[model samples]
Target: MDFSLFAEEYFDEVLRLLRHLCTIPAPSGEEDERVRFCQEYLAELGIEATLDPAKNLLWTLGAPSQRVTLFMAHTDTVFPRATPLKLADDGTFLRCPGVGDDTANLAVMLACVRCIVEKKLPLHRTLLFAADSCEEGLGNLKGCRQIFADWGDRIDRSISLDCSYRGVYCRSVGSHRYQITAETEGGHSYFAFGNKSAILPLAEITCQIYEIEPPVVGNSKTTYNVGILSGGTSVNTIPQSATMLAEYRSDHRECLAEMETRFAQIFSRAKEACPRLTVERVGDRPCMGEVDPRALDELSHRAAGLIQKYTGICPEFRSGSTDCNIPHSLGIPAIAFGLYDGGGFHTTEEWLRKDSLKPGFCIGLEMILREGEAE
Candidate 1:
């Protein structure tokens, strides 16, 4: 298929839309502004978009049918509400908080809708374009959960355009995140000498947990990390409390369960070693697994081929999580593709490659065309 034609025709509009999207500050749960922008933009393209109670923006095209295909991108960015989303001096890159992490993806979804409407592509299955909210941290995957609860059975497939800069993600690398807190009675460091310190026990527990071997096999990678840690009140005093946040990722559910079991053992050992210590698991995010690798391979290969045709770079497997996890866990066919090259995703130095926007638009257009032909 000749995707360049659409790119050539809509290049200016695509750039404009991307720039506009980068200006909106839609941090995770607070996606009201971004949602409004998408609803209005979709409306301009003659597509009816709706916002759910969770502030997820959904734009529907074609009639609802059994073989419905949902195209999803998150409207929420990783930046906080106060961060300024300003384009930089360099013309090639746009720098801002959350520019590439998701705003670029949102822009690509919008451009796809415009292409579909302008080109009048005949889609056999209903196309549902969604700008999901609350994909980061404590927001959880509420937006996607809502979609699954409402339309999962009728939907045949899902294409999630999330924060990828490399290749396509066909296999679901499931992850479980937990917040652990250890506490003890406060005391003076010198007076409480030889007494168990909460910080020391927490550190020892973390080391023991990391020492446990992961059970994942084959090409799939299984890993664990302690991302955050905090404890201790003063340099001269015995710390009364300590807390650590950790996450484990693997392609196999059993492997994750095994790791969880091992973690419990380690915690119990830590508690036994330090009678004052207490451990608690405060958060959990399920791991995603592919239902059919062959089917996913077929879709990914075709999508990668189209992306390479336009951008001269084939898509790569991304290890990060997204709303695709929801469908992938449920055995639904799904893939998370990137719309642009984004860097420093959750930090102040975040930037979006402007040059990639047009190519991304073409890639998404081609994906939609291909979806219409799926048997």
Candidate 2:
């Protein structure tokens, strides 16, 4: 379908909405303001959006039907509440902390909802619009898990607005995250020169963990990283506690299990070196190995066709761990697609190309319309 007229009329408005959204601090578990903004924004368009206990903002269109399709984008960012979401617009790019990842997609979701309402499109099935929270960091996909837990049976299919606009995620990459801590007696560095420090064991564990070389098989690979490490007080003091946050991701369930087993063994070996080492798993996202559902595959191909038609780029289908992981693991048909061209994910320099917004918005709009027609 031609999207020129729609883009001409709503492109600026969508960017404005996105700028407004980017300025709001909606770090996981603290998305009240963003959720409230979405509720009021949709309410002004005569759509009553509701906020669930999980802090997910949701709205529905058309009459209730057995074939329900959900379109979702996460509202949370890896950045904390104190991190500034400064928007820098130099006419070609909009730079912000989360402009590319979910914020851009979230804007696209809102834009599609608004467009559908404005066009007064004929709807044959239920269309559920969701802005879920807690998809990043320690939040552990709580919002999405809640979405499926509460409405899995009735929902026919779901889509996540995530990753890159250049591809569709057909497989879910599972992950296991943990917080490893080491505690010991604290003393002055001069006096404690011969005693064991918490930092020593943390460093040993991190080194041991990183020493592991992941095996890549077919489409799946096992990988690990230590993302954060913090400890110590004064420079002259031997700190009593040190902690590191580490995680492993793999498309194969067996690989994940094996990695966990290795991690346990590594921790056990580290404890012998420092007696007080402890490992606590904090996050787990299940992988749906190499999904090839015919219906969803058709949907993906249709989306890829639109991407090529509008942007001249052949969209790729790949695996990723996203909010769709929960539903996909539950045997519900789900996939993740991206919005906008950008980079610097999970960093302060995240940005989205200004030119990509319009096409991305159109792609999402069409994807939603097509998914709603699924049999």
Candidate 3:
């Protein structure tokens, strides 16, 4: 399969598909509509597609062996359904919410599969393309978990199309997300000033969480964040309850475990001060598990080589928490690489250059076809 020729012929079709997909409101956990659209689009292209229990769209092409090469692009974005998408195509860039992060990559993945079927490309390995759901905040990679659960045994290796073109992630980052709430006796601000207040304990916990330094183990780094904090019945009333959402992430399992210990101590102290406090674990993402060092290096280098071939740029190798996390944790060699050049991901200002689509598609196609070779 000559991706250069394929891109020259189908570039417009892929771009049009990307633009259309960006307009749809496929927020995390609400990706049914977008997945349905993609399934129908593949149907029109003479490809059969299905939705797993977790709503991951799956399309496969068989070979002699049951072992398969997996290609995945998450379909959901960080934006909500009500986010107003204002597209600005300045004849150089296409700017809009959810346009770059994984939306464009999903379209590119679909396009490559379409090209393979259309060109009657011969295959040595079975190929599976997955457009998955719930990759954004709070959704916690449920889509990918199902993908591995359904087909882990037969998966030879996997590649996730995501992020920007400058970097590719080989190791999976681990994370733990938690929601804490404090309850206490309530009264008017002036009258119940002496009463146990819910806000005080939660406030102290938030401060203490920031006080702990992030862990740095070798090249791996850990980070902490308090994303949402809300409480109080009224401005004038003493708060009866308060709640906070917080998380910690690390590229090393030891660092994640260390943070978990520190977090437990923090919550334990708070619990002693306020017996009514409650803590719930909301999300747990896996770190890279034991795998052959050479296998990991081989997959990462292969993807990076293709990117440099297409774009004339060296790609960075790093670790990240993405859809590849599941496969990587299962000891399968997986890497998440970008299919396009873009920035401002997970924000309304997200954009990608219009002209980079061809090279990006070329790289993605090569990644799909082993060694970029056609028999």
Candidate 4:
């Protein structure tokens, strides 16, 4: 098949969609403007689109059927509400804080739908295209969670376009995020010289957790990190309170469980060392496991072959989590793929390689077509 033909015919429309999505600032929990834009765009394309109560935009092609294939991408970006979005001077890149992270994925999803419609292809199963919300930080995977809660049983296969680059992520790297806090009675350093300090306990606990070797089972390697810490007031006064935000990630669920057990043990030890100290667990995000290995391998092989045939780079397994985690946890066949070459995400320096869009779009379309035919 001549993939370039598909690219040539859809280049203009894809660029137009990318420009429209780049201009909208749809940060997490605030995707109203972007949702409206997508609804109108889908309407123009003659696809039936609706915005659910959770503010997710769902577009369907063809009639509702028992066999359904879902194409998902979050409309929310990591950028702030007032970030000014503009095309760069070079006319090749979109210059904005969150343009590459998710906006690019949203645009690519729209482009794929446009291609399917413009080509007049007959789809056996219903195509569910969603521009979901609440994907970053505490927004949690609420948007996708709702979709699965509402319509999970009907979906035979699903894919999320939130990779921010051209890659196929079939393996799920589950993660557990925790906010740990310790508090103690406050007093001046000189006056409280013999008293237990919250900072001391927190530091000791952190050291113990890090010093322990992370578990390794099969292909999965467990990892832990204390990403954020805060507590002390001044040099002369002992800190009364301290907090550390930590996370554990592994491809295997057993690894996560083992780490969790170790963490609890360390916390308990800290409490024994400092009688005045108190500990609290604040928040967590569950890890995503791999889909059926055979199914995942087949899809990966097909996707990698197509990508190599077009872009000369075979796609590889990714360890990051996305909306796919929600469905993958539900035992649904899901993967996250992207259409741009995004680097330095969540920063002003983030950029997308414009040339990647064309080939990426073709690959996405090919994957959808193959998936629709798969039994």
lDDT of each: 0.77, 0.84, 0.87, 0.76
Model 4 per-residue lDDT tens digits across residues 1-375: 555688777777777777778778877888999899989988898877888888898877755587787888888878787777775726676566666678777777787788778887666667777899987776777788888787898887777877644578876666767676777876889988876666887788778878989898887878888888889789888888888887777777788789889888887787777665555544344565556778767766776687787688867777666787777777777777777676777776777777777887777777776655525
Q: Give lDDT tens digits, candidate 3, residues 80-141.
A: 88999777889899999989888889988888888888887767767878999988777889
Give the C-alpha miss distance for residue 201 in model 1, angstroms. Answer: 2.8
lDDT of 1 by residue, 1-375 (tens): 677777777777877877788787777788898788778887777777888888888867764466678888887776777887787739877887777777777777787778878878877667777888887766677788888888889777888887754778876666767776777776888988765577887788788877978786556677888988899999988888888887777876778788888888887887787776655554455666546877777777877887788888866766556787788888887888887776887888987777777778878888887776535
Give the per-residue Cα lDDT of candidate 2 at 135: 91
Better of 1 and 3 by TM-score: 3
Cα displacement (angstroms), candidate 3, residue 210, comes to 3.2
lDDT of 3 at 45: 85
Which segments of model 4 are wrong by more than 4 Å?
164-166, 271-283, 288-290
For each candidate, how many residue pairs have backbone atoms clashing (under 3 Å)? 4, 0, 0, 3
Task: Show the colliding residue pairs in model 4.
Answer: 174-287, 174-288, 175-287
Q: RMSD in angstroms, candidate 4?
A: 2.5
Candidate 3: where is the Cα deviation over 4 Å?
Answer: 213-216, 234-236, 371-375
Mind giving the per-residue lDDT tens digits that candidate 2 earns over 294-320?
867876787788778778889788878
Question: Arrange candidates by TM-score, highest first: which order?
Answer: 3, 1, 4, 2
Comparing candidate 2 with candidate 3, which one achieves the higher lDDT? 3
Instruction: Give per-residue lDDT, candidate 3, residue 151.
Output: 89
